[model samples]
Target: MRLFILGLGYSAGHFVRKFGGAFSHVAGTVRDPAKRNDLAGIEVHAFSGSRPGDATLERISEADVLLVSIPPGNGGDPAIAAFADVLAERRRKIIYLSTIGVYGDHGGAWVDESTPPQAAFERTRLRLAAEQAWTNNGSGHVAILRLAGIYGPGRNALVTLRAGTARRIVKPGQVFNRIHADDIASAIMAAILHGRGGTWNVCDDEPAPPQDVIAYAAQLMGVAPPPEEAFETAEMSAMARSFYASSARVSNAKLKCEFGVTLAYPTYREALDALWRAGEGR
Candidate 1:
């Protein structure tokens, strides 16, 4: 199979590293190909979410599978905005990586794909619109993976704590679901192989407090965790504070049942333990 990815960011990059060998041809787009020295041994093209080059468009047309990891912007979905006509001609499998934040603040309650998306937040509202844009315009099989907090490798709590940047912000009764990057890759592969169109919540089995993850990471590293700060009084950016607005324990039962995916790390504990063993913070 031939694979083309749009907005090859963290999770999508991991997916390529883990599963790029599965495809006969693997190519992807980055905002600036010249800056991505790490993306060696693969085709990398430049797409700033506006006008795509002719070569990139040709490859996109030939791809059997396309993975979109870009979020919607002020002009709406970038891929659709740029290549709607080109993409409209072909039939292929599409996997869209979305966030569980679309469920919004659920009062720490469990939510599934059937729950109506809470469009209270503008970010999530755009995400919902982008989801429909892909589904309605792709002219192919589309699987939307509603992901949770994504962390892995150099981006985990272990590294953040060692850098003296880990925060233990305490919000009473707030819990969030997270997914390891490896598991997300697995889900993307599963959805591609399943050859079906649907939406699935891709997250770990555990819904944990943010502070708990940091404390556990510190414990694993045998170091002191950052002091806790109450959410109300904590210093945070508007973007960081916006994340705390949603508190849903997103369910992944459908993903498990349909994709037959068994996450390598079912919770933050296992992920942290494994990362520690691999010398993440050292």
Candidate 2:
């Protein structure tokens, strides 16, 4: 099997690292050609503008599976806009990475794949649109993975604490779901093996407070926890504060039941503890 990735970013990079060997040929697109050094074994091509070049189009035609990790811009999904015709004709399996933010605020309630998306933010609205675009373009060959906040090695609260930029922001009754990068890779692999096409929520079992995660990381690192700041009183950027608007516990029952996925790190505590033991937060 051959795989083509539109964006070889952090989470997608982990997927490639874990599953690239399974595919006989693996290729990906990067915004900068210089990042090819970072992609290692995969064949890399430049794709910054809306449309991909002839070389990329050729690769797309030859691919059996396509993973789109690229975010949509104001103009909509770049990949869809550029390659809708090509994708419509290929009949290849597609997996679009989306966010749980598309569910909007549920007042700390549980939201599953069955819940209709009520996107409040422009970013999330674009994600919902992108999911629809890929589903429409791929016909019945698309699987949309609505992921929670992604955290893993080199990109976790541990890294933030070590950098001295960690903040223990407290918002009462607020909780968020998170998924480890490795689990995301496993989910993608499972989806490929199962060959099921639909929407699925990919996240951990726990819905935790933002401050608790930081505190856990600090304890694991044997450092004093950052000062607590109330969300309402804290000085934060519009983008950062916007995150506090949504408070929902995303469910992964569908991922486990449908895709038969068993997460490597089912909660932040397990992930942070493992990262700490590996000398990550030194």
Candidate 3:
């Protein structure tokens, strides 16, 4: 099956690296022509100006399955809306990557697909609306995967800590669920191959304290862990601090039971250790 991906950022990069050539054909869209080189060998199209070009619509028509890892637009994707009718007519399978942040500030409780999204923050509320809009409006089945925090090789807590800036921020027991980028790719592939129309939480089994993760990464780097910043005292941007304020652990049971998939790195400790061993400290 041909898989067309919109957006070539972190998650999209993982998807492309893992499944680019495996499919009958692969195509990707980049908002900037400068990034067209990044999607080399696969079919690349530049979406310039304020809107999508005709070529993008044509690519959507050709795809059997479409994966959208782009950030939720202010009012859902205009690009997707541009071809929604054609996409529905083609009956394409869609995988829209969302975030567990939609279930905002659960106070460290476990959440499942049935959990109503609290969305304490505007960004998450927007994402929730985007997910619903695509699923309800499209004729094709939309598999919404509410992903947890994503980390990998150069883009993880290990690297952040090793950059001589690991802060043991204590929120007095706030917890987080994270998934390895490779595992995120695996989960998406599993959904494409085995899942039906539904929503699932994609996260590693272990939920951990942020401070503990920071300490472990510092130990691996052989450096004194960065200063402890109390969550209230840490100088944070409005957006950054707001995200940290959302404190909860997500449940991955639905992902495992529904997709029959297993995470290669089931815990942050294991995943971070592996990353450090790979010389991620650069």
Candidate 4:
């Protein structure tokens, strides 16, 4: 199979790293090709949501599978807008990475694929529109994978605590769903194999308080946990604070049942344990 990725981001890049050998050809787009030398052995092209290079266009034309990891902007999906002709002319398996934030402020309740998207933020509203656009007009089967907070390898709480940047923000009754990058790759593979367009939640089994995660990492490192700051008075960026606006335990039962896959890290504890063993912080 030939694979082409719209945004070779952290999770999508991890997918390629894990499964590139399965494909005969692998190519992807980054905003800047010059800085992506680390993506050796895979064709890297430049595409900042407009005016894709000829090489990128050629790869898209040749791809048998397409993974879109880029979020929609104010103007909507760049891939759909830029490559309408190329995509519409051919059939390819498409995997779109969406976020569980579309469920919007579920008040710490559990949300599943069947729940209607609330989309309290404009960005998530744009995501919802982009998802519909792909399903409505995509040339072939489109798998919409709604993901949770992602962490893995060098990007986990362990590394943050070691770097002295970990924060323990306390919010009453606030819980968040998270997924390891490895499991995200698994979900991508499953979506490719399933081949029947559908939406599924991609997350671990836990819906945990944010502070507990930092404290656990500190414990693993034999260091004191960062002091906790109440959400109401915590100093955080707008985007960071915005995340606390919604709390939902997203269910991935559909992913497990339909894809017939087992998560390597089923919860944050298992994931942290595995990361610690892998020397992520030490």
**Cα deviation of 58 in candidate 4 (Å)?**
1.7
Backbone clash tally for model 2? Answer: 0
Off by over 4 Å in 3: none
Candidate 1 stretches with Cα past 4 Å from truth are: none
lDDT of 3 by residue, 191-215 (tens): 7886467899999988888888888
Question: What digit string (tens of lDDT, one per residue) describes model 1 on residues 63-113?
Answer: 999999999997798889998987888899999999888898889988999
Instruction: Supply every candidate's count of residue pairs whose N, Cα or C atoms clash at under 3 angstroms.
Output: 0, 0, 0, 0
Please, what are the lDDT tens digits per residue for candidate 2 over residues 30-131? Answer: 899784677888899888755678999988888899999999999899888887777866677788899888999999999898888897888988888888
> Which 10 successive residues of model 3 have the least lDDT summed?
44-53
Clashing pairs in 4: none
User: Could you give candidate 4's per-residue lDDT for residues 171-223 as a string of tens digits?
Assistant: 99999999999999999999998959989999999899999999898888889
Best to worst by lDDT, what's the order? 1, 4, 2, 3
Which whole-number lDDT from 0 to 100 does residue 282 have in model 2?
84
Q: In what order do the candidates fall by TM-score, top score first? A: 1, 4, 2, 3
